[model samples]
Target: MYTKDKYSLRTVLLWTRRYIYIFVLISVIPVVLYQLAGWKWLHLPWRPIGLVGTALAFISGFKNNASYGRLWEARKIYGGIVNASRLFATMVNDFITNEFTENNKTDEELFLIRKTIIMRHVAWMTSLRHALRVKKPWETSGNNTSDKEHMQSIHIQEYKYTLEEELDGYLSDEEKNYVLDKTNKQTACLNLQSKNFKELKMDGLIEDFRHMEFKNIIGELFALQGKSERIKNFPYPRQFATLNSFFVWFFILLLPFGLMHEFEEIGISLIDSLSGNEIYFFIAKNFIWLTIPFSIAISWIFITMERVGDVSENPFEGMSNDVPITTISRGIEIDIREMIGDDKTEIPNPHPEYNNTQM
Candidate 1:
């Protein structure tokens, strides 16, 4: 996600430049037809266009609110994952002990078991984020030409590397093969974790009650994963999104037509005031052409708001403004590895930020 306090005006202009071109064309045409071609009948009643604009405002507000709700929900789900990862690491380090084992393993052996479980949990997170990053049919954040260009400067690690490459050191060769064979690798990773915890209990490395606690934690992870998947799988209602676009465009097209007569009246008033000055009277006579820039500015606001809602609707689409799942997962790995006293050199560093953006 963008880490800066605000996006610069230059950046916003660059991202929406294409729409500006369209708006200028849409606005200029009616003004040219009215002023130059003498099509005075082109102007529509101001009241009808005002009513349409008010309706468009309400629809746009509804869309943006719903989109923000989805984005916030996705972030909270990952927040839960972050907390659960830390708790799991602490439990593996402290709860499993030789105090209850008849055949005690060495401290080094115990450490190895703790490291394995922790590392496997990292694999689970990696799989889950990669799964979310996979593009859905309805997701359109980076699909447009302008968005694709904007995303070039932002690094999305999931797009660059294969899941197998990412899981190399985290999963054992046999476990990697088992996970790769499954369609849902995240689910497979969690199943391996569950089996490992059960075996640890069977061998008396963990108490029976502690085993139950571990199971509970696993169940929570499953719930969190399911929540994430639900958002990724189901998109914002297409009917609303589609209709919102249509309404915004309808209003933009009607704006210049409505402004024609409004500006004409303003020009007439100005001409009357400047009647004694030749130069001022000439400038005032052509004041109706001011509709072009006014229409462009107003239309830009509506179109930009529509685009904001569109991009925010899918928080996992790898856009710069979406949730930084890659960075969050890497951070969790770092924190949990440190909890287990793993060598600092062995643990991977946090993912780098690009252009004040994380992904």
Candidate 2:
């Protein structure tokens, strides 16, 4: 996600330049036909176009609100994961003890135990982020030519490594193989964690109540996973998205037809008021051409709003505007490892950002 205070105007304009080109063409066609081609019938009435614009405004606002809701929900799910992970780490570090075990382990052995569970939790996180990054048929974040080119400036770490490769240092060979064999790797990792905790409980490493508490946290994580998967799997209602696009385009194409006439009338009034001034008359005579820029500006605003909703609808699509799951997962890993007193140097650095964006 963008870490800067806000996206620069240059970035926003560059990102939408291709669309602006199309808008320019769309706006120019009708103005040329009406003014130069002398096709008087090419101009449209303002009332009908105004009605369309008003309807388009409502739908655009609705779409943006829904898209923002999806984005915020995704972020909140990750926030819950962050909190649960911290709690899990704290419990694992302090609860497992000789107080409940007859066969006591050395301090080093206990630390190893704590480290193993914590790392597996990190593995679960890695698996989840990787799963979420998997492309769905409906996700179109970087599919466009412009977006594909722009994505080069942002680093998405999940694309750089396979799940097996990322799990290398975190999971044992047998566990890794077991996880890789599963349809849902994150669920598999969590299953492994639950099994480990159960074994620990049986061996008296934790009291019965504490074991139940761990199980509850595991269940909460499972619920959070499902929530993330739900959003990733099911896209924003395509009916709304598809129709919104049609409406916006229809409005853009119709804009210049209505706008050129209004400007033409204004130019006529100006020419009449400055009847004897040749320079003012010349300028006023051609002022109808200003419709091209005005139409483009209006079309750009509407189209940009529509595009914003489109991009925000899928928060896990690895776009610059997506949730920074990679960074968040790494931060959780760092915090959990520190909780267990892992060597500071051994913890990997946080994922690096590019162009003030993280993925």
Candidate 3:
């Protein structure tokens, strides 16, 4: 989701700060205490430490690989949604030609059908994005009434007024109000579209050509909806995740003890000649030196991998490197409106700030 020219080191560090702290605490504190206590008796076995370190390394690699796979899968699914949306727009435009030229439906009825379907498509995209992010769609909609008073105070009115004005005479007040109340505009639009399709069928306007065309478009929409749901519901395997995390933590915990056995047994004067107090200090110092930096490095890898998993699990959240759902949704709305031969101005552009960067 990040839109900058490149990823920032500052941002990466910020996201992984918590893990870094854990590594420092595990590695540094013990070493510092050892230096103060002058401990020299503490020691660990080299062979076991080496084995643990090796195992930890393997676990880190596997976790990174697994996380990347989830991220890539999420990307692919969103890509499919994008393609399907475009295809649906094309079908709608082609199938819903000036209905009067070949049918009994008036210009007004045909216009309503086209506009309603297009708007509904837009609403659906917004709703799906909200659902993915676990946010309320209505809250994000610019015309939300809870924020209406604030907008009014600042004299920063939104498009609600204009939309209402446009539909004034064509739709009843109740219908107009209903549309305005809808937070998931795209879903609402789709429902209207389905109803319109049924009406066309009942009125004998569902000629073979148009029927097939409309059916394909509806099919694409349904497919897109299913795909989004799949991404939301189906995540990476839980077993793999649990195993990888367990090994990583286990390795970190045992690392200091392993190093102590290997290095302390050397019996160098610094450790062997020390008095009781000094001996403890020496042992603790060695422990910390071995523990802190290595723990930090390993912990950093685990933390980064975990974060990658989190981002991958919800690709549509508009997070850094996550799918640009808001932009995609806006693009769909624009393309559909253009296809319906409506003025480009009728389709509101997404916020410039949001479109420019990954949230």
Which candidate achieves the best TM-score against the true structure? Answer: 2
Weakest 10 consecutive residues, lDDT, candidate 1? 2-11
TM-score of each candidate? 0.96, 0.97, 0.70
Error of 1 at 46 (Å): 1.9
lDDT of 3 at 302: 60
| Candidate 2, position 46, lDDT | 93
Lowest summed lDDT over 10 consecutive residues: which window, candidate 3?
151-160
Q: CA lDDT, every prediction? A: 0.91, 0.90, 0.58
Candidate that scores best on lDDT: 1
**Models ranked on TM-score:** 2, 1, 3
For 239-328, candidate 2 gives per-residue lDDT tens digits of: 999999999999998999999999999999998788588889988999989999999999989988988798889898787777899999
Span of ten consecutive residues with least summed lDDT in model 2: 2-11
Instruction: Report the C-alpha lDDT of model 1 over 1-359, residue by residue, as the tens digit.
Output: 76575765666678889999999999899989999999989999889999999999999999999999999999999999999999999999998899778999998999999999999999999999999989887777556877777777786888889999999999999999999999999999999999999899889989889999999999999999999999999999999999999999999999999987898998899987775888888778888888889999999999989988998999998776689999999999999999999999999998998877888
TM-score of predicted structure 3: 0.70
TM-score of 1: 0.96
Model 3 bad stretches (over 4 Å): 3-5, 98-112, 135-191, 202-206, 259-291, 350-356
